[model samples]
Target: MNAPWKSGSSGGRDQFAAYLCDDAAMDVLRPIVADLGWQPEKCCRGGLRNAVQSLSVTASPNILLVDLSESGDPLSDINALAEVCEPGTIVIAIGQVNDVRLYRDLVASGIHDYLLKPLSPVQVRDALTHAQAVYSAPRSHDAAGAKPHVSTAVIGTRGGVGTSTLATSLAWLFSADYKLPTALLDLDIHFGTGALCLDLEPGRGLTDAIENPSRIDGLFIERAMIRANDNLAILSAEAPISTPLMTDGSAFLQLAEEFRQAFEMTVIDMPRNMLINFPQLAAEVNVAVIVTEMTLASARDAIRMLSWFRAHAPQTRVLVVANKVQSALAEISKGDFEASIEAGIHLSIPYDLKASSLAAKLGQTFVDANRATKAGAAIRDLARLIAETGEAQADSTAKPSLLGKIDFKAMMPRTRKKAQAGG
Candidate 1:
């Protein structure tokens, strides 16, 4: 008889391997083995890594079945598999028993799918099928040579409300927390703070792409990307003061479109003054996270901008974010800001000056620098909400790494004459 856990679904188990420790489970799986139609080379047992290594040499793409019922070290085996499993490896673990914590741990450690022990061939087949579906599914734009996904434009209604900071932090969050591939495309043109915000040095960034759009492609763009993580990439502004940046041009918009097509998620920290072609960009974007504070001046600008977008590009989603919501000084409430703008507030980010300033100076995101800080918590909450709604909410604590802190000016060796001849 099949294991009780086995179900009806084939689970999309076309070309996958199943590792079984117990003879009983192995025997149960034996009958369905032919039905699975997996390559003989794909099946094996020892540890997760051995199966992973088998697939690595083959490199033809296969599902991994790790029998975790054995007495050997579990964590060690998992670590070994983690080292070899690149982007495509779909790992399914056969656990000893139904343990919630173990399931969570395995899932957290990168296993694609999991099942409890007393494995039935049907259950194994189902898991394998599900895994293959994920593997064979259309590769996200993140992987090389794929069409990019939607882009988010982070713009400020008023100066100093932390648009750059929000963009930087959200990029970090989406890449780090969700494990979604993300690219930060700094579109602020001249005087963009994205490079400074991420603490990345400018070396043929957006400027190069804008000036030479014809030469841009996945490989060229890949080289331009600074690795935010395995999942996240960043393209900073071209040199802020480069003479080529002075003219209003269509090239910038073209670059943005390329970014939109090249990344799973692209975030643009736009310049305050909308350049001539930016309206084209704004219209094409998936989400525009408009940052505003409580003051009347900021609110007025935000309203005007909202109205312009509403009239010109009604199809795009515009999220009016009330940033720095908290203040010692009396300011208009969230309700008032929404009323004045005639647009609903999408998210309210509290004012945490201390954390925000530290993040800016250190060139790290607030979510990284101080997760415990109010601002950091707010951003995390906001990120989760956006991910759920498939929306963008105007969004920092991150401290720059020691290496990230070095700048062009600091890198140059200072010539110290005789320091007053040893004083």
Candidate 2:
């Protein structure tokens, strides 16, 4: 079965672009391109590299056809091409391998479609025809002058930092308190506790949606979501211990887009194991929240994660939440932690062991169980800040006036051997 394109309707392919194999593949594709009414200048030889080099010097067409038969690492090659490719460019890859994994990976990485090689005119025509249709489809936009959907991804610098707890509270505030349609996606398939935290049961909708994206639609999503209340719903799964759960990068992109269309705000509980795909996922969202604590080890890892986001998803606004904060007994003070990272801590949730443990046992959220507590009040404020405005103002007192004055490498603790040798 042919995979469906997200938009557009069938029409002429005069504006399409292609980079095909130099030998028989080009000969086979030439007549097909002409029959479809695409321009000859849009077609070129030299495969993925040629397409990248050409796009660097000129504008990218609406559609891009890359021949990956000769590529030893097609995934990496496609990623390089994507950096130079235009925003709306629909990429269709042609390769000799018929592997299901390869097809899934390419689709997951944002390619429009994939056609197995040893070329055929019929396949080429059909794929391009579908691409043209999707390109022509009208895009869905929010009502005129309405705020666009906001998506926030909450990722932990290290495990056991209460990332899921914070994500859940944020979703609850958006739906229950602020009265906006909210979706909390637990991307952690195996050990996810998003459902349990809300006192709801895990469903199979997320798993099915990832495995077969074509089946995803409004009805499918509605059925998959477990309703917590009138405004809030959750999409999560509970995988069996023996069953191996794997994530498809493209499927996640599709899922995130779908969530944005259906809700005003979406909070994602990102799993640490999916770090490989985090950059792609991070790029799709408007806000990224990194959950860490007041510790040297957490600080080191947080710096690395912050640096990665700076490089991969620079456009995304980042916030650091210092969870379980305790300055009295802690080795590093909050001010020192913020100074080391070169970014102010956006929110600080005080460490309250008694309240946290009680809430966990009762399967109730911290804010719900202890609304009067310090931690509960802090979480509520965080939600209001995100809901009303997309960002929180950094504490001017804590945040350094100039980032250039702070040397991050010098802040980290050095081993005794290195310190002694330097001396």
Candidate 3:
């Protein structure tokens, strides 16, 4: 079990609280609460809904035991409770049902443990003791050198530059190839394709976090993010266009903080406007990947974005990737574009329209669908560059890469010149 999921930092709140719908449950729970040195009077004569109402106004306790016996839709109501509860609260759901599937689902949703009602003092005590241990582990882990985290914010200089494509591919490579647990956070709100690129349905995770920033924690993150694989999970949304995006960007920052503790790498497909509206969102970002095309608009916007990063987030590494490169069709030459931005191009992916279509038709990432193509190879090189940035940060003498270098910078911008250079 993930100890972070059991994260229980009791920030000035009660040590434990319970809302039971029945009197018998309370009679059994009170004695155990007193034994643990928690205030037994904290247990009230209500169910999950009451806990939601009370916690919405006050800080959540270190450990919570909520009665789900009364909830008509326990899973849905659990999500509702998540909206009100603060992070670092270990939740234990008590219900009358004894289905193995239900127990697994509840634990997966961040509950420390689910106790079937007819609550035995011994079973409850043992569960609480284990939850208490889990609650105390993260603080010690932090003291003993927290795991290194890498965060790359992928931004499009202009729309339709395949920014989401590049972002999703990088996340997939980190998880699938490198075997690092990764998260892809698509901040496009109304028009994100981070989940779609992976053939996943965008869940309510991102929107839920936006609506209830306080609810975000290891458990909320585990439940909210739709898993793409064993190692990769994504938080994205297809919010209604009619309903405008609302938030001060605090939720995104909080989500990123939790991710730093939970996963090894996080790739954020952040749109240009969001970055401009909330510059502080990049404060935790380790690298800023500027995805663009060989267009005059892309060059102009990339310059503006480069200057913004230099001014606002100088600590973050900047990588310029020119995507969908078609030398003959390009409005501006790569040399001219680089000159315009005052930065060198880190990687330029040649356009392969057929391979791209094949990826979409099969519902796979570009690199995965067409690994033999130039574009796919270029994307892999980009992934390596981004992955190594974190390694370099953790130790000056990072582990040597097994991959032979692919010199993306040596490839020429013009097709004929590139052919001649290669020959």
Candidate 4:
């Protein structure tokens, strides 16, 4: 039982390694792995036996792909290898037979997934991509039995409700004030303003990552983000208006899982048009903040969104933020709004046109412009509440770090700068 398997002779090690018994399968898998940016040390034709022997001597990688087509008894071969495989290792079996019973048995015996033979490049790539997701899942629990990362989704009931503003502020506060590594992802590819709001240029890699999710990794993510500071990074794409934005639900979910693994906090500014994948995205996050105005139309839309969340993703904590609250305007009362929506108002941001416009003109966040203002204070409180809810225990008096500070004047556009100077 204590016998060690011989390690592979290959000098380099990789997070994902594969062992194939068939020459045809190896030919198909090698280039796919290379294209995915994985440098697997062992890609030889020893099959499951070779993999078992190799893993016995060396530590198992996060993901292990083994071919069981040649094994007489695939189940028995896998059981023997299970003794040496690491506890959290995700095993993906590629075999010649397409038996559902065998596949079910392998999964029951702790295998992550199974793939049939004659694997094309796309088939092998998708299987490995899914395996990466499983390996990246937060398996380690904290003292409170919570995952290490915090995922927050900011959804607007309708457009022009300052949802992006709130999401950006929360992300900035998490990185600057709370000193947490945060990722701000704006799902609105064409009309997204998260980068512009933060005075950072939109990156083209985001569109590439979304379109080709199989290529997403640490290096890809680092290249995709527009680094605002040491702890804060923004991921958004500014495609042309005519550019067709098409995406599947699985891509968004996979991307979100990767973000969760990469950052301490992940804040998403969801697009209003992405209703098809909104529920799936909301299910993955720890909290969902729905932004709405005080008008009846906004309240009606908020109720519909709330009902959908309750029916689909009940486990996710939901918070309703009433934005642009103006006492002069004829709007619904706070109590009536809560009663209609069946959720309390977690935050109520007073309408301050002057302060909001000034912050936008300067390309600075409201909290950065003046943290003591009503809107700024409310946003800070929202960030603190989200942190506390996620069990992140942030100090009440925390301030922005030097690296996190944004020079709004320098970041301002030349036209805006000239206009401001003339004024």
Model 2 residue runs over 4 Å out of place are: 1-19, 22-138, 142-147, 391-423
Candidate 1 vs candidate 2, TM-score winner: 2
lDDT of each: 0.60, 0.71, 0.77, 0.72
Put down candidate 2 lDDT per residue, 286-370, tens digits, no spaces: 7778999888988998898889878766656778988998878776888889889888999999999998888888888777888
- How would you order the candidates by lDDT, starting with the best? 3, 4, 2, 1
TM-score rank order:
2, 4, 3, 1
For model 3, which pairs clash? none
Which prediction has more favorable lDDT, 1 or 3?
A: 3
Candidate 2: global Cα-lDDT?
0.71
Q: lDDT of candidate 1?
A: 0.60
On lDDT, the candidate that comes out on top is: 3
Candidate 4: lDDT over CA atoms? Answer: 0.72
Residue-by-residue lDDT tens digits, candidate 3, 1-423: 111122235557787889999998999999999999989899997799888777766777777889998888887777767766656667777888655445434533555556766888876887677567657664633414756778898999998999999999999999999999999999999999998999999989999988876567679998999998999999999999998987755577668867877799999999999766666566557888999999888888998999888876676889999998999999999888888888999999998999989999999988889899999999999999988777565443222211111111110010111111111
TM-score of each: 0.55, 0.68, 0.62, 0.66
Tens-place lDDT per residue, model 4, 1-423, is 544653433233357888898788988988888887887445767899998788777777667789997799987787677666654456777877755345434543555556667787876777777666655655443225534678888999989999999999999999999999999999888899999989989979778876776677667888888988799999899998887865544456556756765788999999755654334455456788899998888889898888877776665778899898886784888888889888899999988888888888888877777687998999998998899887432221112311121111110000111111211
> Model 1, residue 234: what's the lDDT?
77
lDDT of 1 by residue, 1-423 (tens): 111221222343335666656667666655555666656544455545455455344432345567877636665566655444333445667766554334434433555555655666656665555555556655444335543355677889887888988888888888888877788877666667776767777566667766654445456777887876687777776564646453333345445545655556777788666622334445446677888888989988887887877765565567777787775663787777678777788777788778877887877877778688877887787667566545332111112211221111111111111110111
Separate clash counts for every candidate: 18, 8, 0, 1
Worst 10 contiguous positions by lDDT, candidate 2: 410-419
Displacement of the residue 350 alpha carbon in candidate 1, Å: 1.6
